[model samples]
Target: MTTAMGAALRRIQLGNALSAFGNGFTIPYLFVYVSQVRNLGASTAGVVLATLAVAALLVLPLTGRVIDRRGPLPVAIAGTVSAAVGSLGLGFADSKVLVVAAAAALGAGFAVIQPALATMIVWCSTPTTRSRAFAMQFFLNNLGLGIGGLLGGQLVDPSNASSFVRLFAIESAMFLVLGVAVATVRLPKAPRLGDVVPAGEGAKGGWRSLLGDRAMVQLCVLGFVMFFACYGQFESGLAAFAVEVTRISPATLGIALAANTAAIVLTQFAVLRLVDGRRRSRVVALVGLIWTVAWIAAGVSGLVPGAHGVATALLISTYALFGIGESMLAPTVAPLVADLAPARLVGQYNSAFALVKQLAMAVGPAVGGLMAGGGMYGAYIVLLIVCALGITALALRLGRRLTPEQDNPRLLARRSEPVAGSAAAPAPVACSASH
Candidate 1:
């Protein structure tokens, strides 16, 4: 049984890694492809990327509903196929309309895929093992991202537009193959609809039930802020900063990204093993602090005029530290989301979490760019302040909600024990309506 469990985990991890690789392949070069190759300005490219985030936010609720009804495997297959089609179309698109359409399609597909993937991970593990399972997924995802970034840097030659287009074609093929892979795998049946009994009563009351829970609400808020700050630094600002502030060649930038990815991949399991169910909010808070410091370091490094090599090294180290914090925080957040969610609305709960993140990713860049106009240091300072505030908020909220007794594993184990004469509760019904 243990061996079988391990094998199942291995399969899921491999699938996640492959899926993430396919998903990440285009991101490293997307802005460059849009701006330099397509002749769109940086602001325009940012808007295009933001459009993807908007699509994701708009699509996720509907996708979550579909996953609740049809199960994750079918949704995963559809999402992967859609992503492939979109990416392939992107290769052929010359006009802004076509590009935005393709980007929207890609974003929609990814949005559909995320909730299903997360649901599958949850389904495959016991609560005790969920954090580690997610950690493994995160590790492989980051590793694949690093590898994809490195490969993209090599593949995307500005002098040869054909080469860049070919890379997109290859990315399209990978997505298609991954879709098939997901389709081939057998997944567990989804929980029955309407199975969850809400703490309150009324139609559409499930949402109110979820919102009424202070802990869950706070978790969602923390998630929003964390992603808002992190994405602003890593996704929007990091590459541009590397190009402008550091004199490192594009190849070296890729290496530095690879190093950041390596830190996430290698350290995730170790961090997961060390942290487990204990001090989850504290761990998240610490991650925020680490990220803030990393941003500060990166900003400070930029102030070292003309020492581009040293500055670049410091910047990479800063990103590496951010990666480490992310490695710790990412896996922890999912399980907490699951735990805090009412049993009946897990899909909705997960979708809400994704929504917060998508919203953050969508809006963070424009704000970051505005602050960063002064310089990289200005951007870094803004990020640092955001992280610090986010951490403080999370700590205070979590501290008030979680008691020392609840934090004690032995106490939790005892609390979880069913009363001697209690009837076995029926499982919550899964709602199937499209969002």
Candidate 2:
């Protein structure tokens, strides 16, 4: 990379960390701030949460087209400004209507940020460095969230509405800072909508070309299941099971969560090295295996519920194992998304995948909540174990559809194959969707 590109990469990563930190402050506290601190009812708070999802869904399709047309930096700056405004509004809004409206703006902004930054990363890094670039992004993001949450927790007092307001203000400030940070980044010129063969074709063909690709669709399916089985369950299903079945205290749950974050923060680099030269599909498959063990450990924790010490240890182990799977995925799935897209269409592809994730997250909680059912009959454990195993099966299936270049990028690096310019870009894999 050139010196300019290196500086740009650093700025992007720093901006990402700051933005994540800002979100961490507000995201965890939203329900409490809305339902109790703001004196709105639980139903209203739930509406606010749902509004975020709705706004993302409404805006993401449009966002993809705009990114492909206008490039990611402008869109990202716009999103940052929107989020800052929404954060300030949410901080002070007393009425449920205002709260929901603020959430809508925040959600739309959040939706755009993913694809915009992803595209920026693509522009700044060559394929050889892309996986590691994304891994570093993931690591910094988690670190920022953990620290932000810790600080927010320290400053917040449920009894004091002003404390919550102060937290939101701080989050708003972070967003504004991130906006300034992103504005300073200089990206390399790449294909935009205007550069495509036909002026209007890029816009119309963006989603069509993406959806027409069998492998991309399959990967999206696999991604959806991956998120639904794990991330979806983290706070609602798994936490509920720990509390109701394992009979663990809330403090223990906190410890388990801390263990999860700690495991990722500590081990991400090591895991990145391990994944560096391997097939991305195989790394993902390994994540499935790791998470399989995690689910079994989760089951073990609840099996002998009366043994509190044993259950607590096993539960913490479960979270650590999930953390390991997360670490592996950080370098695998995201880079694969970049590799699959036509250079001009990276933003659309990222947006589509992010859409899949949001959908799974939205649905996962409901399914997990139902499955938790106070941990009756071990249903939740059995279901998640199957999901983990399913992840492995799906990964291997997706592997068959991937080009070797897509599956293992390091081979290109090792052979000194050029990873830039139109000639250097690998051809899309030719494979049927039939499974």
Candidate 3:
């Protein structure tokens, strides 16, 4: 790569890392604050978080349109500013109603950030290099999450609201800083809608066109299920399970999450290089199997002698497997989405992708919380089935839709070749919020 290209890539990576840090810095604490400090039940917290997701879901598609019409940098600037304001509001909230409102604003800001960042990433690289770009983004994202968890753990004082508020204030400041950084970066102009030739032109289409594509739809469905299984374990159940079944302290749980983050950061590139696009289906299937086994082992670890340590190990292993799976899934999925989408409707395609995932994010916690409340075992059982089903569905769908040619590494390398008469060359679009 040229020095200029390398510099640009580094800048993109830096932007992504900062964005990830801003996101993670406040979120772990937000959940803990809502549940523990505010004295709300797990299910109630889930509902509140889910409501924020719903707000994101409502706005996410519109953000895609905005990115298509305007440029990515402007949207990113708006999003970061909004997120900062929302985080500050969340810090000041004194009532449930106010908290939920602030959370919704935060979610909306995130929704705006998602597509703009994604489009920028997509625009940055050739298809072959896009996977590595995404892997870097994913790695930084997890690393940031780890750092945030450690920071939150150190900062949180159950008896002290002042400390909690102060941490949130820091997070708010970080968001504003990130927004400014986004504004400083140079990005290519977005393509005009009329410039690109629409794919699947004969089909009656709007969102329906994007949704009706068999492979794209199946991928989205699988994404929903996969994320539902993985995120559910952490968001709704882990802390309670640690306390009740493993007899571990909140601090230990925080440490374990930090460990998970470290594992993600250290191993993501190695895992990404290993999985590569040609083997994505197999990799995904293997990841599902690993996750299922991890969950089962986690459940049974509770029955082991020295249950706390065993359960912690099992859970950490589960997260490690998730990180590996995510490494593979994140890179491959975007290229696949781009492949399936009408070239002219990149915004719609990106939006639909974000929309489905956000919808799942909205629903998964509430459902998982309900099952977990029944029993930790019940929650694991539900997650196991979901993961297994998602794997099966992804394998079958991709097997049918993706030909040997599509899966061929040589063909993938040729992805940067422009479709004849297409409006413009395809760009590397990374959907950052997909994390």
- TM-score against truth, every candidate: 0.83, 0.93, 0.83
Candidate 3, residues 1-435: lDDT per residue as tens digits?
A: 234444555665676676666566577667667777777656656666776787788887676556655667788788878777878887787677777887888888877776666666666665566677777777777776667656776877977777778877877887777676566556555454564435644323556666667777777877777777776557666545555666667767666666666667777777776767565556667767767676675566566646556767775666566656666666666655655655455666777788877777666666666666877555556566567656756765675776554443446566656789977755443322210
Give the per-residue lDDT of model 1 (tens digit) for 90-165: 8887778888888888888878777777776666665566677788778888777767766776767887778778
Off by over 4 Å in 2: 192-197, 374-377, 417-435
Tell me the lDDT of candidate 3.
0.67
What lDDT would each prediction earn against the true structure? 0.70, 0.85, 0.67
List the RMSD of every prediction in angstroms.
Answer: 5.0, 5.7, 5.2
TM-score of 3: 0.83
Q: Which ten residues in a row have the lowest lDDT in candidate 2?
A: 426-435
CA shift at 226, candidate 1, in angstroms?
A: 0.9
Give Cα distance to truth, residue 110, candidate 2, Å.
1.0
Off by over 4 Å in 1: 1-8, 36-47, 190-203, 238-255, 306-310, 374-376, 379-383, 402-435
Tens-place lDDT per residue, model 2, 375-409, is 45387788899999999999999999998888998
> How many pairs of residues collide in each model?
9, 0, 7
